[model samples]
Target: MNQELISHDGPGHRWLAERQVAGVKLGLERVKNLLKRMGDPQDTPAVAIVAGTNGKGSTSAMLAALCDEAGLQVGHFTSPHLVETRERYRVNGRCISAEQLDAALVHVRDCAGSDLAVTPFEVMAAAAYWLFRDLDLAVMEVGLGGRLDATNVTDPIVAVITQIARDHTRVLGDTLAAIAQEKVAVARQGRPVVMAHPTVTLAALRRIGLTCPVRKVGKDVQVQDVRIGGAGLGTQAVLRGRALSEPLQIELSLPGRHQLNNAAAAVLAYQEICAAWPKAWPDAVEVVWRLAEVPWPARLEVIETSPMMIVDGAHNTAGMRALAETMAERGKRWQVVLSVRDNRDPEPLIRELSAVSEGFWLPRMQADRMWDPHKLAEVIDLCAPHADVAVGSAQGCFEEARRQAHRSCGVVVTGSLYGIGEWLGRGEIVSPRLRRWLDGQAPQDQ
Candidate 1:
């Protein structure tokens, strides 16, 4: 580790960024060893591990908010931050300070030493665990497939799997069963597992077999009366299960019908935690109210109303399908600005977007792994031959989409979160702190 790099916030961030070349080293051995060297800071009594192809971030955010409302000092560790790397490490809904992050990175660098190589995400996961050591509770969102994800190093009190689908097929597997098997690995023996997915995924899990007691949404845990209201009205859901004394109605500020299922899974996981440590949490009503207030960004988020601009981090086929469904229900044929990572399959996403979009804008995300704009446009042309397509820089693409959209038509920014982040940094979306931080860094054309 370079002493200079470990001494400042910018240098520390660059140090982590440099590790991307190492790529994703899936497996817990390095993380586990690093934690052990640091005296096992991840050994906590209150921890929840959430794993899935989609909805994990939102679910984890909901769980963290609910736990915070219950008066516990909650530590939330998520990934692929929208604005800043510090966004991945949060306590009670507030991002960790740059100074704190720098300090934690110094410690993490020391723990890994000069020889033990770990990926950027593994380092961040260790740093978060170390930083959250003093918190009352922690909610960890798996960065990749659950089985060998670095976040799996911790012994979670409860495990959650939300809406499994065909994603990260290169790493997890090609089939749904193989993907389900990897996700279900987060379920520990003798602990409760909460899952919200289709019957096919459940069948896949059954075939793979699980040692932990699993609770399925709409089966063991019931969710009914799911109503997704108009834009900004939020969603309402009725949840019931062995964990609850009676049926509970939850109103989530987050939009989408799929969010209701995520809420059910979060409620079930919280209830399991409450059952194990009854005195640690508040009444169910209070916790339910807090769940409704979770502000999970970039999920069907309507940032601008006039010629509406909605940004969502829906990178996979399942998420694109959900986005398409939501847009269809709203009765708006969107002009979409789409970008995706090189690892993901763009054909299915393009097909889904074409179903609900009037035209498509293909943008090159300002990231190392972004898919080529021309290649993506070629796929878009093949998938939806009739739809109009434009290719350019991320900002230019979004600007062109917004310019072309009619008064009644909205502009939807979908695909990779990095693309959305790049678009957000382009002055259309204003986040003061993020903007200030971004200005200090080297400029990207996007």
Candidate 2:
């Protein structure tokens, strides 16, 4: 857990904060046991587990929205929240109140007595499941790789893998195939696993020992005539898939051509769900058109217009590549304010980013394992010798970058979602819960 995340003043918050000492234990035993004690709320609702390196969050959000449009009360769980911890749990696109989260945490703590050891993420997952016990369906974005991920305890009706790439190398191995193996394990024998990335083929999945049916993007679901929208707009495409009755015209509110793959995966996953429940199916055209209304934050999220300021959660190489590709298509160079987690290999991210960047501003982030600004600057110099670089506090770097971009190109804050959260907290785009946290107050204390 990050230092800032643990600083909240509340009983439930304190309980979760103390579990940070146990750190990230990536196994399912403790979580499964903890949820069992809570009466296994995870088993009550229909589940769709989304696993991938880059686009899982967007894919999960899109799947939830599609389900919502079909008249299902949907619960969504995502990790490493951008602004508020409560953002991790949502029902029908609305975040649960702090009281709801805290009450659930209290129940989780009582269920997880002294004997049952659990990590922070496990506790959160348990709470989300318990809170969502009555919901019609739930969409969970895997916090890490899927096989042993805590979220894998549920038997998903459908599994979604979107754009697997080299990430978490220290834990998931150093190759894309090795990473895909871990992600694909979320699938079961009878269910369908939607594979959206071009690199992860049915052959690769077969080699990795997959028994479940694989529905690939280009084959099972096709996205054609992809038009990357201009500045301040999103991509539009025609979705054609075996799961759909006919080809549907789709417009994504989230920018970047990369999202087309994610959208396809969501559609396939929803179709798989409908196959099982039959009654869950809605008017295909009406619900498919709702893709344009999905509200996922921080992926090319624009915070301002004049001298446009955008914040993206492009921390890894694949994510940075997508961001770069989007910028290249728009033919716009940006002044970037960036910081990444220390565990990542920053060279590839810098190389991809520098290609579409005018300059770089390395900001200090108030989270654990964030890269040192000076160290990041050294890599930036090696990666793009022509681009100017600055290193300082978050406020200093953001102000300087804003000023420089105002004179020339637009400004982008990216490289880490935590860094974007800090920037969002300081700017006008803040949730009330996050504003309270930034001000060091409990929600009720304010």
Which candidate should be chosen as best, given lDDT against the real structure?
Answer: 2
Q: TM-score for every candidate vs. truth?
A: 0.90, 0.92
Clashing pairs in 1: none
**C-alpha-based local distance difference test score of model 2:** 0.81
lDDT for predicted candidate 1 compared with the true structure: 0.77
Clash counts for all predictions: 0, 0
Q: Ten-residue segment with the worst summed lDDT in candidate 1? A: 437-446
Model 1 lDDT per residue over 134-189, tens place: 98888999999988999998778899999888887888999988898898888777
C-alpha RMSD in Å of predicted model 1 compared with the true structure: 5.0
Candidate 2 minimal-lDDT segment of 10 residues: 435-444
Off by over 4 Å in 2: 1-8, 198-201, 207-209, 278-280, 428-446
